[model samples]
Target: MKAFQFVEWQRPGEVRDVPVPEPGPGEVLVKVGGAGACHSDLHLLELPAGSRSFAPPFTLGHENAGWVERLGPGATGFEPGDAVIVYGPWGCGLCMNCRQGMENYCQVPGLPSPGGLGGTDGGMAEFLLVPSTRYLIPLGDLDPREAAPLTDAGLTSYHAVKRSVHLLGPGSTAVVIGAGGLGQMAIQVLKALAGATTVVAVDVSADRLQVAEDVGADETLISGDHAVTAIRAITGGLGAELVLDLVGVTSTLTMAAQMARVLGHLTIVGVGTASLPVSFGSPPYECAVASPFWGTIPELIEVIALANSGKIRMLVEHFGLDDAADAYQMLHDGRIRGRAVITPHD
Candidate 1:
């Protein structure tokens, strides 16, 4: 079978023929359906080898959905031909967080925390071997190709927004920075769950902002010198009660902090390496700032439920396995409007 692999550190991943994996006890094998091309993949390629705990030569995708092909011994609850979404995070099942279904915050040491994140070979292939059925969620009637991104793009946004949902009340405001794939998902999520909270979307790309509006954003603004003022004015100069920074660069972070209301929540969900030095007045007093990782298992189920209910859907551009590199290039150039999805099989 052919798979895209990060064969070396500080280099681009390539499609290569590899052995089709066989699932072991308690594991399951899934035929490749669709794999999301995330910006974090580009970041992983650019990052230095020594920066992470895992080395390369692993399959390169994390956001994935597919149909069950076979089950290893002792695997139950799902049968062959059932559609499923693979959870991105993989942690020691015995850990306290994993026991609570919060494997995103897996406390185990010395293993790849997320299934496709590091050392774990991911779903960018003809087949993926999931270590446990715990990482697989039934997709029901949803198309695996279209629903693949819910594993990461959708789940991550849900986690970030759900954490700060308490601040989103009727007539209150929430700001979403970077209206790309994850940001667009955040917009729909806020609309579905935030209830009557003004959902504002910001991005440098006017085209992407337009998509945000089509999805659910109540207001859209271009990220620039006046971005802060626009957000303030939209919230009646009180600033937004919740700010989600999907773009974690310095400038966006600065604008995010400025747009945050006092006693608000600012959550950074991007993978950018930029850092912000907090001070007395930067984020306002009583503001709670945090960088949340991917969603919990229960949250992932909820995200899938939202998708299944037609409340949220990912706008995806499909690519065959051979064109996966082109998909990555387009995503890196910011040419893809929404999520870039690679269909490893027909």
Candidate 2:
């Protein structure tokens, strides 16, 4: 079997022939069909060499969907040849957070955090060995390529929007910054689930803003020349009730804080790294700033259902596993509009 292996930090992944893994007890082996190249993967590759999270010689594609090749002992309720979506985040099952279905927040010590791909052998290979059967969700009638992005890009957006749906009631507003893959999906999720009266999308790229408009943004703004002011203007000076900043840079976070109403919520879903200055002073209103990771297992199921029911369309661009380096380059350059999905079998 051939797999795209990460050989070094800040370097292109190497495509090499490797032994296919067999599932252990309580595990399953999935024949990789489609794997979404996430923006976080770029951060993983860019991690300084020998850093704590920079583990090399491992395959790196976490947002995955494929068919079950074999099920190990104790892996019931699913059989071979069943199409499934791989939930990549795994944690200690006994933790409180994991018990509540929020495995992404598990508090167990020495346990694997919810970060896969870099931490574990992920889905960038012909066949992937899933650690636990619980992480595999069956995708009925959903194409692998279409459903792969929903695992992370769509799920993350859904979770972020779900946190502020109460504030997004009638006559409310939601501003989504950075209209990339996750940002565009956030726009759609806000329109479909939150019932946001007005959806303002901000992005530097005019083409991305246009894509946001096509996907249900009430208005779009270029992230320059007072982007927050434009968002406030669109909201009649009250600012948005829920500001979802998909780009977690200092500039975007500052804009989010400035463009939010009193008692509003600002959710950061992107992994953009930037130092933000904080000072104690008179603030406009009470606002909550939070970073929402990928969603829970049930939310993943719900997202899959929405995609299957034709409620939320999956915007994707297909690429072969050999294009892993090019995919990351396009993502870093912001050249790819939708999620770039890698097909290992292609």
Candidate 3:
């Protein structure tokens, strides 16, 4: 089987022929349909060895969905050909958060992420070995290829937006910073659930903003000197009721703080390792700041529901496993307008 793997620290990942893996007890093997190329993997490659938890020598595709090839001993309920989306972030199943299906927030310490992001071989190959059947969600009517990004890009945005949904009511405003893959999904998630609230998207690239507009953003602004003022002006000087800073750098965080209304919510969703300074009267009065990890299993189900109902869809550019390197390069160069999914079997 040909798999794209991260073989070393600070080096670009490469495609390799690796042996197909078999499922163990309670495990399942999925014939890889599609795998998302996430930005976090780019961040990982830029970091020095040991700076992050996960190591290389593993296939690198966390956002995954495909058909069940076979089930190991003790695995049940799902048939051999059932199409399913994988829930990443494997965790100790007994933790309190895991019990509630929020495995991303599991209490166990130093737990490695599942294949692609950690020690396990991920879906970049023709097949992936899921630790358990519990991590698999039936894709229903959604195509596993287009639906693959719903596992991470879609789920992460859903998690980020779901937190501050209470603040987004009729006549409220919500600003999304960064119109990349996750950010694009965030915009759609807000539209599907945030009801009547105006959605504004901010990105440095005009092309990205155009994509944002095409998707559903009520307003699109370039992130520049006037962005803060523009957001306030659009909000009638009140500022947005909810601000989702998907970029999370110093500049975007500062702008997010400035665009947030009193008693609003500011949620940081990106992995841009920058800090936000906090002080009295900073970020307005009574504003809440939160950073959430990937969403729960239940929220993934909701995102799937939204897709199934035609309320949302992943704008995807397809890549074969052989062109996986080029896909990563395009993602790092910010050339992809929305999500990029690699179809290994194609």
Q: Model 1, range 1-346, lDDT digits (tens) per residue?
A: 9999888877878999999999999999999799999998898888887878788888988998999999999999999999999998888888888899988888877643665577789889999999999999999789999999999999999999888888887889999999999999999999999878999899999999999999989899999769899988888888999999998999889989999989999899987879877999879888999999888899989998999999999999999888888898899999998999989987
Per-model TM-score, in order, reads 0.98, 0.96, 0.98
lDDT of 3 by residue, 226-306 (tens): 999998898899999999999889999999999998999988998999988888988889999999888898999898899
Instruction: Evaluate residue 218 in candidate 1 and report its C-alpha lDDT on the 0 to 100 scale.
Output: 88
Model 2 per-residue lDDT tens digits across residues 55-79: 6788888889999999888988888
Query: Clashing residue pairs in candidate 2, if any?
Result: none
Residue range with the least summed lDDT across 10 consecutive positions in model 2: 275-284
Which pairs of residues clash in candidate 3, taking residues 3 or more apart in a chain or in different chains? Answer: none
Say which prediction, candidate 2 or candidate 3, comes out ahead on lDDT: 3
Cα RMSD (Å) per model?
1.0, 1.6, 1.0
Question: Model 1, stretches more than 4 Å misplaced?
Answer: none
Superposed by TM-score, candidate 3 places the C-alpha of residue 249 at a distance from the truth, in angstroms, of 1.4
